[model samples]
Target: MAGDTKERILETALALFAQSGYLGTSMHDIAKELGITKGALYKHYASKQEILDSIVERMNKMDYERAEAYEMPETEPDGFAEAYLHTPIAKIRTYSMAQFDHWTKEPFSSNFRKMLTLEQYRDPKLAQLYHDYLATGPTKYMAAIFRKLTDSDDAAMQLALEFYGPMFLLYSVYDGANEKESVAPMLCAHIDRFIAKIESGYRKPHAEGA
Candidate 1:
């Protein structure tokens, strides 16, 4: 089927892009990996740029599905903001750990993250994409959620940093190790401690502790 071929092409291109940075990978490489001619590859994507665009689009689609599966609150401005404030501390822990497992376990996500990590230094576009998905974007989204939960904008941003910082560090820790099992408990413990802090007294009496 045409759709199946197109999906295969995208997967092949993404794997190649991860192994070799986008600029380092030629259309020929993808075609060769797919056991197809360059012309055949062209039928699915107009250019290498098109292939990269498709990969990004696919990543976004997968990212949303992953978030939804984790029961993450919708990031956009709808009426779902209260979900962040009221969601149980235990469920929050579950969602947080689920996300940590996903990024580390999923080949597509881990490979895409590896590609971005490698290519961001060489490409401005990739650098922006890196920030949008892994860095500032998630921070801003969390901050917005925190803002609704707390009274102060500054506190919201700080809470976002506190919440995401361990998750970020654990990614590196996960990458450096071969086994995910060892790293998971560390994340689980960290999330538990963080949430416990939030629950204990993060908010001030007026607004202070958790």
Candidate 2:
């Protein structure tokens, strides 16, 4: 089928892109990997850039789906610290673990991540994608959730930084092998510290009426 062939071409292109930086790869490489002629490849994508664009689009859809799946509760309970500590903490852990698994386990998803990370420095489009998806996107999403829960944009931003910053750092430093084993505990530990800090903030008394 036309759609199947197009999907195959994209998958092959992504693998090649991941193995060799985008600039390092060529249409011939993708076609050879797919066992298709260059002419056949053109039937699906007008150019190599078009293939990259399609891959980016597909990965972006996956990213949005994951983000939406981790939606925060609409209303906080009677106690802020207690509610967050008990509910979203667990949910966030689950969400983070799922993210780790997706980034490490899924071939297409993981390769897409690697391709973008490697190419971001060289390609402006990839750089923007890196910032939009991996950097600012998660932080902004968390900020919105924290704002709803804490009622303060500043506090929310702080919490987002505390929560996402270390995790992103870990991701950057992560080597391919044993990433889940190596990073899962650290991620959870960071989450624990982050929640403790949030709870500490709630316990602090306001300095006389300002």
Candidate that would win on lDDT: 1
Error of 2 at 136 (Å): 2.3
Per-residue lDDT over 31-139 for candidate 1, one digit per residue giving the tens place of the 0 to 100 score: 9999999999999899999988888898889878876786777756334555665566777888888777767787777778878888989999999988887888878
- Estimate, for each residue in 1-210, the C-alpha lDDT of model 2 and write its tens digit: 888888888888889988998899999988888888899888889999898888878887887687568763434323433334445456867877678667766888878878878988999988887788788887886776566446688987888898888877877556544545777777778877876775567423321211
Q: Which ten residues in a row have the lowest lDDT in candidate 1?
A: 201-210
lDDT at residue 175 of model 2 (Cα atoms): 51
Q: If scored against the real structure, what TM-score would every candidate get?
A: 0.88, 0.77
lDDT of 2 at 164: 84
The RMSD of every model to the true structure, in order and in angstroms, is 2.9, 5.2
Stretches of candidate 1 exceeding 4 Å from the true structure = 75-80, 202-210
